[model samples]
Target: MDSTYDLMEVLNHIDPSELNYQDWINVGMALQHEGYSVDVWDRWSMNDRRYHAGDCEKKWRGFHGAGTPVTGGTIVQYARDQGWTPPYDPGTALDWNDTISTEGVVVDKNWVEGREVTEPRQWDPAKELIKYLETLFEAGENVGYVVKSWKKDEKYLPADKGAYGRTAGQLIELLTQCNGDIGGVLGDYDPEGGAWIRFNPMDGKGAKNDNVTDFKYALVESDSMEIEKQHAIIRELELPVACLVHSGGKSLHAIVRVDAVDYPEYRKRVDYLYEICKKNGLAIDTQNRNPSRLSRMPGVMRGGQKQFIVDTNIGKETWTEWKEWIESINDDLPDPESLDDVWNNLPDLAPILIDGILRQGHKMLIAGPSKAGKSFLQIEMCIAIAEGKKWLNWACSQGKVMYVNLELDRASCLHRFKDVYQALGWEPKNLKNIEIWNLRGKSRPMDKLAPMLIRRAAKKNYIAIIIDPIYKVITGDENSADQMSNFCNQFDKVCTELGVAVIYCHHHSKGSQGGKKSMDRASGSGVFARDPDALIDLIELDTTEELMKQQENKAVCDACRQYLDAHFKWEDDLSQDDLCSSFQMLNYCKEKLDKWQMEALERNIEAAKAKIKSMTAWRIEGTLREFSKFDPVNLWFDYPLHTLDQSGVLGDIQPDAEQAPWQRGSAKNKKNAKNRKIDRKTALEEAIEGSNFGEKPSVNEVAEYLGVSERTVRDRVKEHGGYTIEDGLIQKSDEKQDTGKPD
Candidate 1:
């Protein structure tokens, strides 16, 4: 599909044996559609064993172009699927969203100067062939070579599978004994056409990919560029070449070391080898990807030119070394810069998206357990940014924001925004600045979703992108540090590409999160906590019965005052104590208002009571990278909104799991003796039932479960008359006979 690279060059990358009948025909049709000659198609077809003399010409005549004709792009895509990389101009700059692969780039073809390669002056044909064999194979490895050729339409082709089952050492010894007369050692070859030899060791039978034993060397030959230029790029790229042979034609055959262990790996390595060569201005004949594919023999003659050794062992010594060197130099990481260079003029920091909480072009994660109203909190933040109002306790910069709703349906998500707006008593003046994308059932993993999000929000000028819940879009195992790190990088990509803050919410890990640090509460790997610039964790606070009663009384008083102010002018007449008391306020309202008005006020009072019962308390803890630590923020989740608690009622409440053992004991001490005994009995029963030990629970196990000393467990057992402890185990007195008296 990339027109910069020639179609003919790509065609060589596709192996005919790999394609079915239709696909092979499609390749020919694509070439024909591109205005290429039938002879070109026929010549390439001959590489396949299925080729018939007149098959291509017959297919070519019947090919009338269709309305949507298969263009050369089809062939190009096929080649790419076969691992052909199209040459790209080094001057072209990559777009923000383009994926950059810097691997296997060893040469800057634009700057490399060609190196000259000259033929051997005193050509000893026998010695050249012997050197080629020793450089490529072990002494016992079988060699496959083709000396016999047959003329085909003015071109020489290998007549058959050629000679095989001969050891390299045997051929070397035979050539040495045959003197300068090479024809006596091996079958004779046409004087005009040079002979060819397979680069890899064969199985002593036939020459095919399956017949090759060791997948060591592959041929890199290209005729598209000047011979000297091909030679220079190959060396500059540091291809692990074993033998560099002149083909006695325009191309040079550099037997590069792939060193693959098996057939599949061999194909893979060959593809990688050819891709690097093509990118660096060498157009390789990709059909030579087969492990048993042949290259021109060094000691041979074609017409008037001599096929001799150009150079031997002229690159990196091994395939791995070459590949590592290439990738090490081609990485996109920026070079280190001296701090002294910018000491006087450092760049300004990123602008604040949420004052003291997050910066623009950064990442923030809000973590909480289920029913913590985390999603609602995120929606509130979005509205705050859009209206330039305060989010929770932090002021936000005013700008358009994108809210990605991955957890809720379109209707519910839309209504939630409206509900939150009404709950906050804020006018919807900046509704146009908030855009919601509801993907409840149509969500994809974050890796795939990031680019799509960036593309859509690019022109929207959003200062922040808020993902309501990240669980729906998480890609890999949350427990795997490496995988989760990659998953979190998607957020970084969005922030960097769109220059906006990325704010998302995740559920806290299972069990009580109050005991864990704010950074350790988020579910999965620690990377989730560390990867973000700011981590805000919300833990539920323990609300006592007395606190709930206080909240209910305040709610009722506020409702009564609102009704009296609207229907009767009682505020000026009533004392402050009377107005604040729920009972006094209700009695005053009943005396002044009519029956219908009183009934309406009673309904309002009841609704307020129900709200108090449903409200949940929470504390916000932050781990910030850019700002100093702040005190924990207390809040009340009242249905559709989270309001900061200003009354200090929640300030004294500790997270249930974070309460110290001594604090629990002091609270227990407030109960009467009778109730205290009942509590102890309940604790003993729970410890026995919960213990993993069957039937009779061990005293040590019960003590560990209750977080008490063994002596304390014995006292509790003695107080509970139904249970007895003996031999360090507790059992019901009715179930087990008392043995040698209870300990």
Candidate 2:
């Protein structure tokens, strides 16, 4: 996703809990609905929403310096708002505080030099909760409720009393008359006058004339930068204006007021704007507005015509009411500026918080099959930090977080928050410190945008970014080690520079991880598993119910050869019978399997490095065999290995293949050309074909079929070919050919 995606909001809602966990979730959800990614609550001192919001302002002076002359008021507003009351009184009086200033009883900051008012670093969590609760109230009104309009025959609202029988036009005219200015407002037109002069033998009101009067709105046509040169063209005429970017160029809209056009010189007035536009070289949309037809431009959507946002069958009054409501809310209601002020004041943060965010800052992969809750888990991470709660039910170093959830709506996110918040049962204090970005319905380049967004979200504190599902944002070749490596390397640098943890929720590779390393389990880039400071992999386990079914006889880790000294245990609280508990069992399985996979990957990396070193030694020996001189200074050395490639000593050297230089020059390498050996390509292709592994094979059978050492096969396809095997039929292929034995 692009920087726009970073602007997206977190999806979910908050509740009236004392803990504020749910509220944190609610902020995330709202942002999500609006298309922002957000982090969880970090602490409870500063509120963040206001800080991230927009407002018009003019600074009193230049940037504040460390130590300068300044004015100020009381440190706390509640105390300053009134006198320092005896009970829970503020230490200093608002007016007397030399550093602070007060105006009309409003607290203003003092430009005092060197006066660092270091407040707490927590965000106001209550705001996020309140925001969500407010949304719920709005939602309640929208749910299973309908707005019915008084049809064409009806002219008055059902709520009207004495005037219920009056026509809409009559009501409007009467209401205007009652306003106490008849001549200035109505002129010669009677309170109940004006029959159609032409087609309407009877009077006409917004009667769906179907006349379809095609009138050009906004005259045409300035080309390129000319409009900017003569920018005065836009405001010269009075019309509702809008901005549109067409063909990568900018143009402003001018919607002619329909009501203003009903005059003696109506056609002439309309024609003037049209002629002016044409003279100015602008494109006039002649077919844009059809009088009597509600369809116009986007925002000009009439009442009962604005399909997406307002009611379709709504009467003009209801539409007016809705508009009035929106206007009143937009204009009169001021954001409390509670948590946001605090969140904005916090100092920068480091990334090591929360136990090094899902494993150091490296390209940590959170791999799990679809429906495995990878995204949910990542969001949970956001919640923990934003609220300064625990991660995965465990304590973690906490800080600000930025979650980019390209999936899930704000509403669904709210439901999730409700579930988690109901579980926690408390509202928080410092929710505002957490920042959010809501990005939806966008085709943006994440590589181009993520860094900028990450930088922006790092206000006050460096922000931890968790992209739930790396594939969603990444656009380049996910398989290319170079491209993927560079992509993740950027993140590594960001983590170190901004001191913000970076976590990615990734999908696991297809099939069961019977017994193997799951680095390959990470979706998309292998580098995704390579880059980050650390990585955490997730797995799904059989539930308690499944375990009970197999309770007749079961084996734990060691007994089942999955782990050393691991023992199977049962819990009566969660499980139905002898089976595993639905949630508990799944969690256990995920932990166990996730750890195993991670460990296996670590082992492989170590093995690869060791093998590379050894192979380099071995290759040296072989190179010496070909050289008459011990030092190959006499011969050209074209190993094609840079410092890193040379140092990457791996234990798992190619079976019948060469090491670095060898891999670079072997016949097999030449054939492989663009990338990797044929074997690797064949392996990837095989994987692509398997799609679903279906039934697995025994390890021995697989080792025999592949013609490589069993240990070697385990090193490569451990999860697929090892413990996952069932019978002797180990080899698999795509589009199986018929043997003509059955069917």
Relative to the true structure, how large is the alpha-carbon lDDT of every model?
0.86, 0.37
User: Candidate 1: where is the Cα deviation over 4 Å?
Assistant: 1-128, 150-157, 173-181, 191-193, 203-211, 221-236, 245-252, 261-268, 271-287, 301-311, 429-444, 450-462, 665-743
Residue lDDT tens for model 1, 239-344: 8889999899878899998899888888888888888886666767777777888889888899788998888897899999988887877755688999999999
TM-score against native, each model = 0.73, 0.28
The best candidate in terms of TM-score:
1
Best by lDDT: 1
Q: Candidate 2 — what's its lDDT?
A: 0.37
Report lDDT (Cα) of residue 368, candidate 1. 92
Give the C-alpha miss distance for residue 125 in model 2, angstroms.
79
